[model samples]
Target: MTRVDDPATTSPEQARAAFRAGTVAPTSGWAPGFTQTNLIAVPRDWAYDVLLFCQRNPRPCPVLDVTDPGDTSTVLAPGADLSRDLPRYRVWRHGELAEEVEDVRGLWQENLVAFSIGCSFTFETGLRAAGVPLRHLEQGRNVPMYVTNRRCRPAGRLHGPLVVSMRPIPAGLVGEAVAISGAMPAVHGAPVHVGDPGELGIVDLGRPDFGEPVEADPGDVPVFWACGVTPQAALMASKPPFAITHSPGHMFITDRADSEYRVPVQRNE
Candidate 1:
């Protein structure tokens, strides 16, 4: 793993600088108070379908921002170049992963539109802050993600099964974790399932469809969150002609604050 300054205390600009300087590492724990995101870039012809698909499945695909067709900048991180901002990028051809590279600058196309989706990693900071343990983080591993039997409402030609990320939370903190994360709908908002991987078609907690895996300790409850990777899974099934996405766990760190997506209370209260 490429080591830089601790991300939890790094400013968003500094964190992004590391990514841009060729520091390829998981974005989680970096810039804790800021938002990190999953990315998907599709051709102009397929943009509408993907955008609508995100709209239809808001929980797993909460869109934080969409770049105008062919535009290289996004409102989420103004002045940053989308094609090279992320530490790693995955190129897909007809829905199949074809290449993995540190930068997408070589494949940049004028007809492509990029969609930035809310990542559950953004809520992890709040969970940790609230005293909820995240085993994956403590172990320096990627949170495990699994594909469930659940189906997302289809949109045009874009459709597929849902994907979720798992974090082993202390059984006692499950309620506190839910209450803390549930308020941030834009950051994948709360746990979808609190226990039993079998219920989600995840037969083995030691093996994950994506990312590193962590076992639920003796008294820890396995908690799942709707994941931004859901779109990548859909792309793998739907077979769009051409697409690009951030490599799982390698996210786009944004200038936006994590608090920006939280449920707000009345000013009078």
Candidate 2:
């Protein structure tokens, strides 16, 4: 893993340079405070179903931006190229992962539609600011993620169990973590479950379906939140003819701020 301190110095051009040069890696801390999105590239034929899937499962799949077919530029992140902004991407053909690539420029097609979904990293900064410690961030490991028995509402050919990321929160700070994160609805907003993994049908806390597992300290409860990986799992289950997504923890950094996603409400006159 090539660690680049001062990701602020790394512009979109630098990011593309790193990816094109075969330095793709997990982008957890890179471009902190910027909204990092999960990529879901699918054939135009399956675009509607994929969009509906994200709409129905907002927590696990919050839609931040979508690109027009064959267009690599997302208005959400103007000038940021999707094909090379992300550190790594996973290419799935007929539901099976065909290969991993640093850049997807070769696979770009006129019939491809790209969706940028919200990721938990947007909210982790809020959690850290609120004094909620994150084990994965501290350990420099991928956050633990799992496929739960809870089924996500199916849209067209898309349907699968919801995936969640687990974070160990101190017994005293669990409520604080929930309150702070809940304020940002754009990024999988709050904790879906506070304690007891079995309630969500998660059997072994240490054995996650995806990502690396972190140790939960004594008196710390395993907190669960809906994850963006849900769509990737759904794609694998539904076996779409062609699909592409960012590698786990490798996200496309955007210019949007996490605060911009806060839900706005109008007061009664």
Candidate 3:
């Protein structure tokens, strides 16, 4: 995987073009104002279960769009190839990660149905605009994610523990972060928990279940948000026969704007 210098100004088309050309990198800072998504593709036989799973747990698996069986196109980003536009992908076999690849075109199955789920990255620009410092971006690392003991409501055969991404925010700005993110329900909005990691069964913040460990500063509060990686955790737990997902942090950048997912707030006159 490589790093993109000055990704803040990158465009969705440009990011996808770089990915399509085999450039691998976490998409956190890429194309700042655009929406990013988590990619998950499963056999048509399991499409209903996937949809049901997302419906049962909207906080962690907010679906933006779903492709019909074997269709690689999504309305979220027209002309983008689901199998090739993402930076990195994970291939699952009978519940285990079989391989990590740059592209899934060769592994694409005719019966596969792909889901484009909303990502926390989509709301990051808003977080920045609100003056919330992003430690992972500042540290040049992928956001730290953890698998919790809390279980999600199961959909058919899909059942797994909840997974979350943690960002350490200054104690004073925690509320502002919450207020800014809570408005965008489509992108895993709001903090599921703040403060103690052990409360969620996370033993050590440095050793996360997924992504990289990030360093928190003094007076920083660890804030947890429902993560799109929840589906991957479900696949690992439920042992789906076959599935494909974006490698955590390596998301699919969409043409849509972050404003498209934000919930407008009404003010009192």
Q: Using lDDT as the measure, which candidate wins?
A: 3
Error of 2 at 193 (Å): 1.2
At residue 250, candidate 1 shows an lDDT of 91
- Pairs with steric clashes in candidate 2: none
User: Which structure is stronger by lDDT: 2 or 3?
Assistant: 3
Candidate 2: global Cα-lDDT? 0.83
lDDT of 3 by residue, 206-230 (tens): 9998999999899999999999999
Q: Once superposed on the true structure, which residue ranges of model 2 sit more than 4 Å away at CA?
A: 1-3, 6-17, 264-269
- Model 1, 154-231: lDDT tens digits are 999999999999988888999888888898999898778988989998899888999998866789988899999999
Reference-based lDDT, each prediction: 0.89, 0.83, 0.94
RMSD of each: 2.2, 2.9, 1.6
Mark the regions of model 3 whose C-alpha exceeds 4 Å error after superposition. 1-5, 266-269
- Model with the higher lDDT, candidate 1 or 3: 3
Poorest 10 consecutive residues by lDDT, candidate 1 = 260-269
Error of 3 at 187 (Å): 0.2
